[model samples]
Target chain A: MRDASETEKAVRLYAGTVYGIALSHTGSKADADDVFQETFLAFHSSAKVFHDDEHIKAWLIRTAVNMSRRAVCGKHRRAEELDENMPGGRFEFAADEQNDIADAIRALPEKYRAVIWLHYFEDMPVKDIAKALGARESTIRSQLMRGRERLKELLGKDWFEDE
Target chain B: MNKIFEDMKTQAMPDESTVNALIESLPEKPRKRGIRFSHIAAAAAAALSMLTITAGAVSDWTFSFLGDFSSAFGEKTEAYNIVESASYSNSASDMTFELVGVSADVNIFRVMLDIYPPEGTEFTEENKPCMNDNITFDFYLLNAHKGYGASGRFDVLSDTPQKMRVMWTYSCSAGIEDREIEFVAKKMTRTKDENAVNTDGNSIITDNEGSVIKTEEIWYTRIKTGSAPQKVKYEPGGQAIDLDRLPDSDERCRIFVTSAEIGSMSVKLNGLIRGDLVWRDSTFTAVKTDGTPVGLIFSGGSTIGGEPSSGLKDGDIILLFDDIVDPADIASVTINGTELVFK
Candidate 1:
């Protein structure tokens, strides 16, 4: 891990961003905390040779993403078992409806929303996203199309119409 | 949808407390694992530091150029005017290193800290630590008794400020120059059988107190000023010993590989294979062949005092010990096609 001062600096630089990534993925405060801590620890342990801010930020994001995904999958498995035997229990969303957007994004297959986030939120073009996600630009374009289409369906016509 | 996305943009930020809490919840600091800088420097600089050190007391000392001289393709070597005293620590560990009286080249990629020990000591005949990009400490020990000698390599070095506290109890009576003791060292690298159940009478691997000798490998390189230095390669014909066959127990096995011509040596264990091998402390230990833990006895050296023994976990495989390694070797450590081989 990094020294306390450097770790503190990293926390200041991207903890929020890391936590945002975790919260968006896991949708649970507790799980998000675990992911945030893990991502920072991973970042601290590595990233010493990180060339600059952009590289450090990307390393954090990648770590946060991986840890959050693992947490989500683990939670999903546990929830599946819990709900497996239960009867007539009401299924509830863990986060607010606004965060359902993230849920919808998570629902898409792995590479799909990766491209979408890079394109929409990260404002990265298809070529760069393609390189980052290890996919062809054409494939990223298609995945983006499919992801947006799926998002539209998940949000329903009301969201778009209201917009 | 646009409004929903915008709302997320506002709420997506992780709270300050969460970040603070996470950072706070982490240990106050990273523990210094394996090989303290004092351990390497004190071996050579022990008497010197204790002696009356004057500014520019000794000049024009020659260091062993064991390893290769020619820089490989795409290798960038950054020369730093090695200072006599610098507070350096591994960015990831709590261990700190300070140097006394030396100058050398530093490559950020390999992070190599070539130590040139003081002149006129023992074991100085061409016994150099291999070159490694992993810069841990920059100290040198020149052997006076052996006419001309250099200090062994230390794996950790950085410009960042760091220090490690050591408590040493010296047991050797042979003075600093001629002490030839076979230090019983536990092999840092282990195989499945080493940690597995042993059924045979000749079981070398066991969890019993004295059955297995565990050890860790630290790579070092020697640098010499003026003209070309030497090159040392632990690979390309280096021997790999399997520790599991020798009967399980805590037994110390000391294997001294001559790194006299090492430019750099790449160190790898089965566990530290996937990523950078961060030392718990800068110390290596040996066990009794019968499974007894033998404390590392520091003799013919200064007593900085010891704190605790540190080491890497059993599952960590050091993938890239130096900045440079063959692609095939890198691929060898990949766990299930993943770049990092944690097992």
Candidate 2:
């Protein structure tokens, strides 16, 4: 088991990314909590030693992805109707367009949502995302391209750049 | 998009209290000095609760229901009764396997096997089966009397240098008796890690996926399944809902909350009109009397195949809540805005 200080530091650093990945995949706060708890518990109990913080982060991200997949594929897996009208977060956005964009991101297919969040939100490169997801970089690129297109379509032509 | 992403990142996370509670719940780290006193105490408590048979030779084994890395078995194995035991050693593979125990139910069958590597064998990061994906087990079940045989999916519950615990489960056919059963364990092959590649100076290997894969035979053994537990019905209280009277709804159905257990809950939705009925995504919430939301442990659904416009259809939906709830504490259940009081 990890020391209390170490666990606290790691949790504080990666909690957002982990929870975001869970929420992106699950689309439900309750499911995300289960993923978050399981991921951390696994980390605490893991016997593998990390070489550095990047390795730790990568392992946690990968574990989070795997756990989210298991949760989605679980026997009790259910489709929870997402409330598109609900606020994305506790705080109000400065611009209403931001909320629209957030909702659009959430509305994307599960496969696309994780790649988009990691790439655009987490600022992780395609290679890292590929390594984290145990997939080829080509797959990540394809997902990013397709996810961007879907997001643009949902937000309308005026909302996205033509690149 | 970047601005939106940034704004979203600023959203709230689980508070510190939750994190602290999780850290506290974690099992104590294994002591560097062989075995600690606390380890024995905790193991004794766990063994007592699990009702596990502690043989003289295997007195050191610690059984846990939490399914942590230190424990040889999971909590689910506690429900099973040990019916058979065998010991086999493979010189070629430098391993010894003991068919420590077995358990079964009507719908599922479980086997617990302890694997021991030869002395001086170091279970390092490079050789650990779980981390390296180096080992695999092929399991088979047979009933010669009835001439019924099939393979089952095997899973490694926990692994350690001292011993590795493996469990497998498959659908149990009717009329299959424990006395007539024969379990077969085929030798496993240790495959080379295909992902391990030389990266030169770069931290990441670009073409690692193209690496060659190779395998060599390792350990193998089989043992009979001992006993099976009686099938128990897990029926939770039921609640009735009139689908026609649901808020903001055109469809009509009668739904009942069937069972609620740790990590999962089930509901039976029946008597649907079934015309153009799309089983689209729906949300269900279990709330306390004060309307505080109870966390859902798991979320999944199974579709009951039925003809459209059949005038009557039904489906069983099971939602896994995060924790068990007291029936009395539950005020109501809301599915897609349709609220129904507990029966």
Candidate 3:
């Protein structure tokens, strides 16, 4: 276990990254919330040593990604109605009116969505994304290519030029 | 180029309340590397490694690293060795599960496995190998069966594009013997969708296009070991009391323990207690026979009847002790006013 201060500091520093990864994977705010808590709590409980802040960040990203998938799958299998008021209450895919690019990302398949989210939103290189997700760099590269093509199909080629 | 993606990144940022909830939910104790619940025990076991190094001490129990599960249980190693002969293959998914190595002692056991997924399987977040939640098994010791309550954990020590290594370590206060371990996985939900699944170890698998990938077989394994536990015998005298038998008391409270053990990682002190008490995560001052403070270890007990609300009756109790570096030299433990003297 890490010191309380270490955990608290990480929570402050990377809550955004962890929460974003969870939110992208699960879509439901409630599930994101659950994964967010679980990721940090998992960090608090894990005895895995961290060499530096980058290592810690990488650990958090990996944990968040895996936990988010589990959370979504469990929610689907239970089929239990969540309290609509809760963040994880619904398996929602509705994008903000102002963010059609976000909607396009959401519209992609889970495999591509994850690869795309980490690459574009996080500004991570393909090599780093491959490491974070434990995939071959070639696999990540191809997934990014496919994800971008899917995005272009969804939003058309103009959005690529706009960016 | 990713301006919109960057702008909306903060939209998912957890609020102050969510952050506070996480902070509030921080576990009170540090966890061991193997098991989730045995935090204090794991933390203490970790410290044992440091103490072993600083003093330049050496023992059969002295482990340079706890990452190797096989070295932790069954028998201590002059060196770590993994037997690859025990491989079990599930042909349907082209996944082979091999029991690479195992070790067990009187109070604990460890098993290591090498999981080889199909050649084309990608290590993506969407494509994951099975975890503890996906597998269940029964452990038999001298024909006695245990389906649950084996304090253990399955951890993925390393995962790569080619292979994944998982190690499980468990402890019992009473003791564990070399026996056959039977694992039957009912379903392999490697993927959430209908794209992949297996029933037993030998089910047929199909891709999204319904192409037959591999014929799955029963993902089961039977492991037999020859080593016996190095059990320490204890004297049979401790303070005993009964309240129900007393004419002045009507409280239906009792506790009984058939065995007690103290390992380098955790302590299990099973004893009989007489009081209107429930044993769950309660605090008790613990010390070695030498007065070395056994810091942050927790003890739990159960009653004869079912249900969480029932008072503890004359039933088995197990204590998980967190920090005892050189338990080999210790002869007993003192919890509260009661002392258990081991021979």
Candidate 4:
């Protein structure tokens, strides 16, 4: 029921968030592109109306998570390791550091990586992140703590201390 | 890490051309018109067709029934055997309710309806009208048939800011034999200023918790159940269970394991407990040949003529399992300690 103009506005506003979640979850641009297209098509066709910008964002995030999970579950796609060449890999940080951090995140399990991306990268609070991912806040906290520890080990002591 | 995300925000978004292309592919929005049932009656029919097309394009299958209804009835136009179709307009609530179609058979009676609200109406969690608590449909047989009355619950096939498409299914004690059915809606209330909450933004008022604060004027509508133009028999594939073999249990009065498709199973149950108690997620268990327990992924059902958990009489239930990788792998299903084995 969302008009084209409203949908365009939504795409302009949240395309990065949706694509970022998909890319972070799948670790591949091809899969990310598929998930991105599906997510927006769903938004345009969705019957549920949004209350505010926050609800729209949350719904898109939730849809992205669900689509990413389905994409992973359906097939055995080749998972490319996150590196300097990956989409969104070239950050403000040094090349090696960014690659290392990205690799560390990508190496984590899907559950942990999802929580970490939503929590640290997206700046989402634990409660909202839990709602978005349809998990308990406690579960999100647990995953965040464990994911961070795993990142610390992967990034080494010096890199960890710098944070 | 934050810097990485900021960079991701800049680089990961889809380009403008991709967004434009996607927008171009979507169906154009229907033009806004006066709130009249007759005006959008044809649009509602088109919406039903669009529902099927949309379901196929989108992967989310939550509303698959809408698509199924369109395909199953559209082709055999005469198979649905629609009994009646009625439209009502409530100027006070600025809403229109139409009984689009109704079809009945020996076992099941189904009703399809479309509710059109004024433009700009919102349907968010806080703003969405609580259909379960506020709306009630009282169905009665006009010609004095076998059953006392029809009992069933409504499931929303699609909901938008403009219109909500819903399907109601009931277990009929007898078939429609030249008998007419009447649906009377009672005490229908909608939330007017749902966003009006406490200053802290909590929806709960200071004194009235879980109670309607600012209620819109009450409206009621009576419409005859529409007869589907044709009578279509929908037969799902899978293994059927022998009714006599189902074990005895206090929770379930009687259960018919009708079919087991690849990843899902359907059942009709009359539970022993009171209230509209449909099957719970924890009530059933499935296992594969390797003896690994399969988790119940989803369970959906509609109650006939009672409140949820008010005990079940008879209703259609669909159970989807996590370990149903292949239909051939299913070993057995245990419901309330009564196991039904499959060879």
Candidate 5:
């Protein structure tokens, strides 16, 4: 099992992944910071035992996803009113595509957005996404189909076909 | 299919030094994060340290563990060292809880408590008389690292009984462990609400208008009880979960987790809901606030709720009691000797 130092290192290593997930879901630096802090805090508070490093990281992602979902739904985390003092991490998406992707993802609703994040950003297989998200494989497959369909609808079918 | 999505994940990683800097910024010793009674451990340490500091006592700093965690890309989720916290009393007069110190490796920390009243009482915020006549259990965090803090306070009756407990999660380079501590508050309150108990041994008294009167007043008291410091195992690679356990929709839904061992765990969800929330594999689905389908995401990190789907709108209702989610799904509950049946 990873020790405290190792845990810190691991957390540090995954900071980008965590932030990426946060930014995609929240679309704001402030919300991402809260999600980052909250995800680590949840990891700090949880007591489940893990047999290996994979288990620990899974827990962290799970905690971050859960925290992100809460942030999205919570009134206190509105992106328009983020705290000025929040930790700053440069988001380097191309200016034009950034807004397009953000608006499209935001418009897809939370469920679809969650699936798309796991599939695109996290790059999990449909099966893995189902497990990580606490869903059935068949259901996840369906959601993936619909989420891609929605994205195409928002960004145009050519967007997906082109990429 | 989105190359931008793939590219961002690879490019967004923070450098190792940045992570170390963030970790280094943590108080070496345990310090309060904010001034909420919910922050009992760090606040207690802060209160105690202040006493030593004010009395010119040598710095007898103490560090309590909280928890540790890590995550990976595209993996199943996990919780390393979750625990049930105990209750404690915060009777400090002046409290400060926050980060104090940090070393290259160790995050040394401490919390101080200088008790003056029982938990759940508010003292004179201004120079006026201490109204409410209740015991005040104030907890705080004192950061020696930078000089920032937070606090949690409780105002209880002057004569109410009080206790303090601690549940901590310890993290090492390897894994985590759980520790528990319980301490009785130095000051105890014997004050009882005279209106709460009737001479006839009943907790309620009725008037003649066929209206119900609540004779007993429940005090909004906060106790300082949490687990001891324990460490969690960290992993760079992520884990996996079952897809069948995910909520089917995204709308306001109620989750019910039943256990023959611990009775049940439930939560009314307004946002995203997961199915693989508990230790045992169980049912996970999402419905609207009115118990209809909105969306569902499986344990695999996939989702299924949205507009014309199973998502929720504003003004939806969500409620949770004793981990029992979806109050409507529960047929009945017993609180303070009163049986409540949900329609």
Candidate 6:
């Protein structure tokens, strides 16, 4: 483990970033809590060497995505078992003015949502996203293209930034 | 689209309590594998604050966990240095969390810590303590050079719960240079063992509780590792014994135990295996004259204590154990695979 102080600083600095990614993936605050805790703790306990803060941030984001997938799968299983007792829907969007965009994004698949979140929200380059998500650069480009196309259909033709 | 996603930034930010909880829970040990940070989602706070620590005699009960670890890995691990100074008890709960055993070879480090649950806590059913739901403790090199790939566990807890003492043993890949290390084992949750058949031959695990435990989900214990203070000491003895024709040797492969250095608390098997072996992933069992086990067998590459060993095509394998015993008492040592009685 690197110095505990450094880990603490990472948590202080990147908790929001990790938390936001988890929220984007799982769309639940409780699930976000678990995923966020897991990502930072994994970062803390991991012996994986990092080149810089950006590398650590990428690792945290990837780990968060992985853990969020697990949480989402588990939530699905529990929901299946509990059946109607569980709330079922797209991403549990907050009551905000951005609900239109949230609703539109929620209509996309998890893959598109992930690429869209990282590409548009986090502004991570396609190469960095590939490294973080363990996907090929070409694959990320395709997914970003498809995610943008899907979003354009939901929002409108003018929704494109460079259209 | 960028403007829309940017507006979602404020919505994605984690609350202050979440961040605060992360900070409060940390400065904790560096347990790597995500067994659910008990401190993060831990229900009750540290229970040791109410309990006062008092001097209690270090009983033979402490060493019971050595048998537990032996049973867990299904190996015969010898023990020598019983770090008695590592033993401590709290008078408040009548609970004792003590470091009872330590077995270390060149690259493997195994430790057993015993916990005597307080009265009224449901720690046992028909006298067999259940497996820990999750056990996490982090040990790091304090004064020495940095090491890598050291995995920790709260694995294999005590099967014998007389006086309601439960033990957990965690083994990590620690090199010889990491002789002096600090253990930061904190939170562990104990629940009924559904799969734990009688590890010790006598007890048949017919605990109907697992069929249904309505009272509590699991007992979460906070071992006062930092608050309780004592220096645990281990001295490796110079006794060396060699064995002939190691087990699981094929025509293409040969495994050798060059020297079995039996120490006060551990026997470090310094040996190398030449060529590929028939079976290298079995267990090392040191059955005593009484037909019980007391040794730990760990597998490693050719690197012993991180130094590259030449002349070995395959790598090195280590047979480790606690409980000091004469070579005569060891009925046999099974290494790699199969059995061989050392004379």
lDDT of each: 0.36, 0.42, 0.43, 0.43, 0.36, 0.43
Global fold similarity of model 4 (TM-score): 0.41
lDDT of model 6 at position B199: 30
Query: Alpha-carbon error at B243 in model 4, in Å?
Result: 11
How many Å off is the CA of B175 in candidate 5?
A: 34
Model 6 stretches astray by more than 4 angstroms: A79-97, A154-163, B32-343
Q: What CAPRI grade goes to candidate 6?
A: incorrect
lDDT of 3 by residue, A25-132 (tens): 666777888888988988987667887887788788867765665565455435475665574454343355325676676666655766777787777888888656
Q: How far off is residue B183 in model 2, in Å?
A: 20
TM-score of each: 0.35, 0.39, 0.40, 0.41, 0.37, 0.38
Which stretches of model 5 miss by more than 4 angstroms? A1-3, A75-92, A158-163, B14-18, B26-343
Docking class of 5: incorrect
* Model 4 chain B poorest 10 in a row by lDDT: B38-47
lDDT of 5 at B185: 23
Could you tell me which 10 consecutive residues in candidate 5 chain B have the lowest summed lDDT? B67-76
Candidate 2 structure lDDT: 0.42
Say what the RMSD of model 2 is: 22.6
Per-prediction count of colliding residue pairs?
A: 110, 13, 22, 25, 147, 20
Worst 10 residues of 3 chain B by lDDT: B43-52
lDDT of 6 by residue, B1-343 (tens): 3666676766777768877787677645665432231111101001011111121223312111111111111112332222323434434333233343333423333343434454465444444333322222222211101111221222223344344434343332221211111122221122354433323221111112322111111122222111110112222223232334222223222223322333111122433222112123344566767998765534332221121111112233333344444444555555543455232
Better of 1 and 6 by TM-score: 6
Model 5 chain A: weakest 10-residue lDDT segment is A70-79
* TM-score of predicted structure 6: 0.38
